[model samples]
Target: MAVVFDKPTLLQRIAPIFQGFDGPLVFAILLLACAGLMTMYSVGFDHGSRFASHGRNMMLAAGVLFVVSQVPPQRLMALAVPMYVVGVALLLAVFLFGIQKKGAQRWLNVGVVIQPSELMKVAMPLMLAWWFQRREGQLKPLDFVVAGLLLAIPAALILKQPDLGTTLLVVASGLAVIFFAGLSWKLIIPPVLLGMVGVVTLIAMEPQWCAPDVDWRVLHEYQRQRVCTLLDPFKDPLGKGFHIIQGMIAIGSGGVWGKGFMQGTQTHLEFIPERTTDFIFAAFSEEFGLVGTLALMAAFLFLLIRGLIIAMEAPTLFSRLVAAAMTANFFVYAFVNMGMVSGILPVVGVPLPFISYGGTAMVTLGVCLGILMSVAKSKRLMQS
Candidate 1:
């Protein structure tokens, strides 16, 4: 004989899967993801596949976030060292016999092409956070020295691949961990002062230094040209400066209000380079204008603040460090992308978080948000 039973309600069935999610964080991510989907639809108005592909990527990212958020912070720390070691080892593999693409040796091909540098974006923070957590009570200058060494190795390897944007990102992520771990003010001051002085010096000496014939030994010629281009984009209006000029036009022409969705002349006319990736902000600005730009900026600012709050309230040193690094990474992603697209900084292939169309980056972002959610949920559990 069989017994008949009533089926569980939908919420009862779904509740266990989302058992520990931080509601606000998940909602914030969903909002951004929705905006990304809408923008991608407009970006690929004529090509339905591009928009559909972006939707698929977002779904993939949402899956990653859900799966990853289920893992608690302590267990995350347990996997940190091994993940970091594998990441660095893969970077070495890329250095030794990497696949070359578009003149950069940043990919390691096993069964498929993968950018090992992307691994460091997450791994570096994990490694540093774990390192600091281990030395929580007895931290010293030497520990930071060792941390710097850990950061330098993979960063140098990626730099040799000639991917400056990713190198900067990895370095920044590691430094965020260190900074949150209470590295001295003295350690921070010199770099800030020197950077200010360097900028002043560059501006003052631009006439002779930015000359085409001069060889800049410190940076690759193309990198040096990007700096020069930022200093004065008009110097090569239709050449090195073309991207910046077009981006600026799209942004400025948007004026106080904007041209409305799918109505950006510069975007549709094909003047804005990489309109769906690096320069997506320009197209966005052209359509949404200042009001929409402010709204978007506010959303990012809220995310940043929310992530930092989670970091500050995390129960352990490792969680704090990881959370802070992840939060700072978001700021860098938003600031650098906006700066370059607005012509205030040189173009670096950094995508605008959810707004940019790319699979690997979206997955990485999903992992980041998932980790933050895990940390936040852990705090709620502790309180209960």
Candidate 2:
């Protein structure tokens, strides 16, 4: 017998890539993406071509998502360590000789300027899931300690950059992996308890500690001011509290039905700062009102639930962890942004996922959706 090589035909080559696609996940994401486009059109039309830019970014992101879905989870697992290493290295580079803008040194000009902290959102989960998969059946307490250490190093560097938003995101993504990996309750309970108590203690001591003369050693001045402002926005109504105060007003003005598209007074009058980025949700609420807000929330909630269900059905431990963490990342992005805008939580600059106007953040989310689609498709491809 003679050996012969045959290239796959067009249909043969492409069919498997589209096989086992998760319909509900795809549908939910599309729904959210459409809503995002519509919302951006109304909120960002006057912001120097933001609507056009956002649409372009989203189309690019969707393409990335489609490309990523074609990659198998095993290959993704192999790439995990390299991605994590490169991401951490970039973070170090940023800390050393990075671009400085408006009091934060967060972007690196490595040929092209990029934010390294954004990479950690996906890299952290991929790395940790790979770590756990390697330790599979016989995992012990020491392994989790190592995982925490792995998580801590990059998180600490981002924190030093003083990007509270990215730091929160990185830590939350890592913690979701750790939590899903079955770490002991004893270890989990203490920190959570301490966090709760710390929140209470801070509230109690707000009057004394929030004073201008009081220098909190751990937190940067702006971070402290944000906390104080959260405690009592009225204290600096015209200054630090302005964003939140205006946000609340916009959200409240929506009532049962929104004021109608682009009819938001607060947004049109320029009372809302950063209306297309972190504060876009406020503009959304003002325009869409309570009904529109709830509908958006419901879409997000559906996506969250669907992602978790995929995690539950994942074929491998790595897939499960990655899917679950990515889902939580989406949840956190929405919750934190909404909380900060609505005056429930201190502002941390986290954007609303899939909705906020930023290229890097949109790319991160696109890759995340790719990974999730990969995970969901992995099992069905194998069984077929």
Candidate 3:
């Protein structure tokens, strides 16, 4: 047989590109990709075309993963500031003449309609990492303030767009970068306390402060309803609260053992809303029970732990910040979606990350993972 040098193998020959692969990181990605495929199958059981679309998206994500893992961390650092500036400008464009759907304008149209906020999810951490990298030996107290400003500007815009879920995710991701970059616990404590107080105050004054007569002209009507519904879903079960009520029922009905795969009563009966998106975890719990849930959580934990180990061993501050932020984003995504599904947190329409069915989110997360892999690979190559 003649030896043939094909595209894939020939492409793999580049030194800096695909130099040292991370096994654990790759395993984590594979697990999430599998979970995505399984959940999408259920989500689009009636509409098989969705499964095909998801497959295509996964293929694209994998390609992105490969391409991004090849880029050197130093190069990624160089690309950060420019990318962040572009992201912010796109967000401004969105605010000006974005597409409005369900009374919220989060998507912009330059050539195609897309969510610029998703780009921020990747750009924010990159920018912060680059900033911290620059101030490596002499990180001042005021540096945190500058980073806070970097995070807050776009977060405020996203929040005003009333895309509460993504705004919070982006904030969490950016803060993770700062935290990993050696933010002090003393500095972290005050904000933690204030956030708790704010939550309590919101809950305490849910009726008056969140009432219609308060002239909620600042908030879109549906956003107000979502907050109110989070406080008490029973107030309007048939209206805004329907999704939460149904999701909880589906989850609670699972008991010790699940009702079995594809045999969920609530799911089959069409009682569970957004079963393949934010509420997919609830549906999975309904079908696979406690055992399945634990297995999934364990996989996520393994991924997080391995990611942190990689961050700790990274060759540079930028790599460490990028790795840690990506890991924390995964944690935040899982926590928020599960919290919302269980009715512990307000519904803000954040997806279940890999398990959810959205091309934009899947690709954004894929890119995040790619950055993590790049960091991990750089560390390994230096050691080798």
Candidate 4:
């Protein structure tokens, strides 16, 4: 017998590969990936490790996006419950046996100092969406209560960890899911009213509440200082106020056209804290100026719009909720970081998405993008 080699048919190989996909989503991913690489290159110009690490992270994120796009919506739905349960369990474990860093216990050492709170940022929405999907087209008041209970537990635990930024993100993610799942305006009114009332009361009672002698049982001292610092950065401009004051100065100094990349006086002089991390936005703004800032905002806006469209077109309820929540989460992250840098909000140390340099945050964002891509692609697959 003569030896023979067989060649595979093109359809046989390509058909299964594109079972689900959204062209717009792939375009968005490529565009953001380029932006991320460009910013990382600028930030890590001399630091080979940072550049190489981000490159690896981008590859890992792309792999995640590819794998998630292949998984069916039903399978993702099935994963929601167990992932949430495990996440909650890990959070509880953090309270009992966790790593204590700078007086906060937010990480667990299971051969790695894993932050359970980060998991909730993604899982909380998935869990809530799964719950809402279970009672689809037949929502009730009790459902909202159950959803609140689901949100409150992990949020409370994370707050106890004193990681306020992550706690807020996780809460916002879960709330977004519930809001999209047909949560009544009637139910939303009370929380909105109460929140407004609470802010008023806090402001009116600021003297007594913020007195150095009187301690607020709820917030840590540092947390309280941060909120107060935001109110009047001039109060302690050299101490707790250093971050906001420096950030505002850097942003203000960057006129319309900016000071040019890596040539920013404040950034080069190291006046801005965490320039490569949480406050990277200020550094970027100082260097790139108004034009670059607006361009970045445009990309984020496009992402949010496409994300909303994908959520609306999602084939399943779980997919829709997850997509919406993830989209909202991204917006919140950007809004909070920018606000903090501009001295509009307290310094809670939230990193600027794609621009800031942090492995964990970058990885988390990549995973979020992957999930969204999965939802969008699945919808496309179903329609075709």
Best-matching candidate per lDDT: 2
**What tens digits encode model 4's per-residue C-alpha lDDT throughout 1-384?**
999878879987887786666677667667766776776666566555776787787787677767776777787889999999999999999989989998999999898679989889888999999999999988889999999999999999999988999998999999999899988798799989999998788778876776788777788999988887787788789998999999999888887888887778887687988777778788778888888788788878888898999899888889999999989988999999999999998888788777777778877887788788888777666677
Per-residue lDDT of model 3, residues 1-384, tens digit only: 999876666555664465688988888878977977886787678755877888888888888878898888999999999999999998998889889998789998878888999999999999999999999999999999999999999999888787988999999999999998889999999989999998899899888876667756766777778778989899889988899999999988888788987788898788888777778888888887888888888888888999899989998889899999999999999989999998998888888877877888878877988888888888878888
Worst 10 residues of 4 by lDDT: 39-48
Best of the two (2, 4) by lDDT: 2
Question: What TM-score does prediction 4 earn?
Answer: 0.93
Using lDDT as the measure, what is the rank order of every candidate, best first?
Answer: 2, 1, 3, 4
- The lDDT per prediction is 0.89, 0.92, 0.87, 0.84
The TM-score of candidate 3 is: 0.92
Model 1 per-residue lDDT tens digits across residues 99-203:
988888999889998998998999999999999999999998999999999999989998999999999889999999999999999989999999999999998
Q: What would the per-residue lDDT of candidate 2 be over residues 54-128, giving only the tens digit for each residue? A: 989998998999999888899999999999999999999999999989999999987888999998999999999
Q: After superposition, which runs of candidate 3 have C-alpha atoms over 4 Å from their true positions? A: 1-19, 215-219
For all candidates, the clash counts are 0, 0, 0, 0
